[model samples]
Target: MNLFSEIRSLVLDALAAMQAEGTLPEGLSFDNVAVEPPRDAAHGDMATNAAMVLAKPAKMKPRDIAEALAAKLAGDDRITGAEVAGPGFLNLRLSATVWQGVLAAVLDQGTAFGKSDMGQNRKVNVEYVSANPTGPLHVGHTRGAVFGDALASLLDYAGYDVTREYYINDGGAQVDVLARSVYLRYLEAHGQEVAFVDGTYPGDYLVPVGQALKDKVGDAYLNQPEDVWLADVREYATEAMMDLIRADLAQLGIKMDKFFSEKSLYGTGLIEAALKSLDDKGLIYEGVLEPPKGKKPEDWEPREQTLFKSTEHGDDVDRPVKKSDGGWTYFAPDIAYHYDKVSRGFDELIDVFGADHGGYVKRMKAAVSALSGGTVPLDIKLTQLVKLWKDGEPFKMSKRAGTFITLRDVVDQVGPDVTRFVMLTRKNDASLDFDFDKVLEQSRENPVFYVQYAHARVMSVLRRAAEAGIAADEATLKSADLSKVNHEAELVVAKKLAEWPRLVETAARTNEPHRVAFYLYELAGDFHALWNRGNELTELRFIQDGDAATSQAKMALAQSVAVVISAGLGILGVNPAQEMR
Candidate 1:
């Protein structure tokens, strides 16, 4: 199904033949040999670097080897011709039937055509959107949520056993703030005027939590001291905030497999266990760190602290585990969390953090490297900022959230499909400008609308064919005689369809889900190109007038495009639109 792979295999077989014929060395490795689309389409369909990579090893000129290999490659059925280009690059043109077969392959596999085994069933834990559990998820968290969710789904499609998880930061000062905010709301529920002071949450989202608290225990802690209500209200407010966050994620159709609480690490000896693992390896020690190079704090001084020798594994310097105050540093709990993940026997770990957390990446990766002793690879992805634009001006502020835009606000305006698709139209590390006015437009310039329109138009063609009493179901179309439907434009779509499986493996290997978005866009473009050709050439139309045989064959091609679109959207966690509305 992968045309590039098929061509590469042919090239490798030809190289093996050349080795036997004594045209090349006996043991030169083919590891670096690669078959890729030629830079310029006019040269050929595919090109290989086999000659260049093997020339020095074999002690032979690259052009001499390329000419010999090209003659051998020209004998293969899939490769119609092979010729040496500039600097001994071998350009290959695949036979027309190979492109024709790709369409049939797509029809056979449907949406599963591009699914890959690149992950090899490895277990991977993806931790993302570990936002503070003190309020509903804002727009900043929305980008992380969508990026993480799409990444998890992409790995799953690539055959990894992925756990989509969120960390609840409820054991910090933020939860205490949530408790005091809810206490005020609780008093207000009991008919008392309460003023929110500095360091207290004043968002309306918590007013309901406060009212719920008053309903649970009416007038019991009305004027009491902070000791009794602080502990209980903190628990109450955290659960309430999590509910709002879960609802916001649900609006985007995101549901995590797990939500790990930071509070669970408290008093559980978990921090000691994680640190003990490092201690046993002689990584933990007592030392004083030099102050950060630039903009040192006024009170900065050398203080004895328990540290982890993170520099041994690639950190810029050793990191502190516990401060001189005997309390664990913020890094300690995170180390324990990752240690727990490693002990669970995961084969790999991926953390999706905001771009602001860039400073923490090295130490975190060092911890995983030490904890797993290089057995597991940890990959960290940082998503950049998302700027909002409207009315030719920077559209700042969230109307519903008062201080920031909640994830729900964006989802409600554009729907979950638009939110997921638009977020992925750019690479995760690149800042994305989201124009509310432009994203909602129904035109080719809008990628979301354009991609969805391709799928919708295919469905419309099927519906019209069905009304005309020609069977256009997947089963019927799949059984059509595809050989009768071959054309230059039709073959172009099939060739593009053949790239899906290879594209999936490349995207998964790079841990880049934006490639999936780009692939879908290209696939849609190819399908659209073919669709427009039908307007000028009646024979190019998908539905032939009163000719069910040719109509079934053409419908088969259209449905093949849908198959790839659905699979690509599945990786991005967006639903494929069946209708334009």
Candidate 2:
């Protein structure tokens, strides 16, 4: 059902014909030839760069090749016309039957119309929202969670076996701080006054963990030392914070396939094993790094440290694996984590990190490259900040979190559907300004409303058709006489439907789920435009006066739009609204 692919196949066939007739060279490669929508719709339905790409290799003028290719394409049954434009590009207009057939395919496949096999069931590990287990997820982690979840769903729709994982940052100083914070709360529960100073988590979310600890141990830790309480309380508080985190993600309808603990890498020889793998490749060494860029030599301390030759694998500088203090650096555990992922036999790995972690991208990729011997590819996607606005003013922070807004704050203001959809309206790397006033509006400016309105409008049409005694079931509509759907406005929606399969493959290939959001917005626009057009043109309406066949045919096209909309929203983890509130 990929119309672009079919047209590209036709272009390739025409090139083969040219070669057979000796009009082109015998061994010209057609790999670069592409058939895509024309930049301006006025040019034609589709355009190809076949002649321009083959001109230099085939020793022929681009115009001559384009004219010949146009002649061959014009002979196809689906191609109504083909003309050379702008020296070498060939513009093609498909027959009306082709557009009608696209709608038929949509009805036949339902929501699965645009699903792609581009991934070929490749195993992809998507690690995201590896937040510290100190508190509930904040707004920053919310964006990463939504983005990563949507990406995993999008890849799954494109036929990839994706594992959605969250790496718990529990093996760091932060967990120790959380343990101490919970200890203070526990002391407070025992009727003792306590103070939370710097380097300790003081958020109210940890209060429950403290009370739970008091409930469990009672006065056992009341007079105990740090060594006696630290280890037990660290484990206890981490599990509690993780429970809070899991509940927060559940509020957004996000559930990870696995929760990997950073503590599992410590004292397990895993970090040493990962480093040994790199050392065996001659990538690990003890060396003093050069003075950092823009820093004077005196401003920096030159220390010989155990480092990874990350520069050899694409990093800007070699990264240290162990500090000069003889303890492991922060990157050591991350390398071990990725090495674990590669050892799990995943073909590809994607890490969804916050924008603050941008500096770690190259080093992480280099480590994965060194560990996997360049067999597995690592792609890191960074999610930028989200600034919330209410009534044109910056939204206030959460007192519960003590610093930033929590994920529950956003989800509570707007439901999970609106939150998820709006979060994906912008690319992951772009900063988004989420305005509560604007996003909740019913106007076209809100993409969530616009897309949902289109789906709701289609549902209304189906309901009316059902009430009018017209059998609008799937079987009846899919068999409707689509020949009556020859209007330009009707064909526009069908043409957009044809782009779904192509769009899915493109979005999956680039690992950008925002493209799906953008595409769904455009498709909804086309459907809405056609719906508005029916107001002035009586015959274009989904329900005719007495022509049941025509009404059924038009309803078929409308239902196909809803189907695709549902499919796209499903990938975004958004439930399509059947009717507007």
Model 2 / residue 481 / CA error / Å: 0.8
Residue 114 CA displacement from its true place in model 2, Å: 1.1
Q: What is the C-alpha RMSD of each candidate to the true structure, in Å?
A: 1.5, 0.9
- Candidate 1 TM-score, C-alpha based: 0.97
Which residue segments of model 2 deviate by more than 4 Å?
A: none
Return the TM-score for candidate 2, rounded to 2 decimals: 0.99
Residue 269's lDDT within candidate 1 is 97
- Cα-based lDDT at residue 242, candidate 1: 91
lDDT of 1 by residue, 1-581 (tens): 67787778878888998889888879989989999878886787789999999999999999999999989987777888888998899998887778768888888877878787888999999999999998888777888898899888888988999999999998899899889989999998888999989778777777778889988998989889999889999998899889988988888889999999999998999999999999999999999988888846886888999999999999999999999999999999999999999999999999999999999999999999999998989999999998887777877666445577778777777888998899999999999998888999999899999999999989999999989999998788878888866798888888788788888888888889999999889989999999999999999999899789999999998998888898899888888999987
Task: For candidate 2, write residues 496-530 as lDDT tens digits.
Answer: 98998999999988899999999999999999999
CA lDDT of each prediction against the hidden true structure: 0.89, 0.93
* TM-score on alpha carbons, each prediction: 0.97, 0.99
User: Clashing residue pairs, candidate 1?
Assistant: none
Clashes of 2: 0
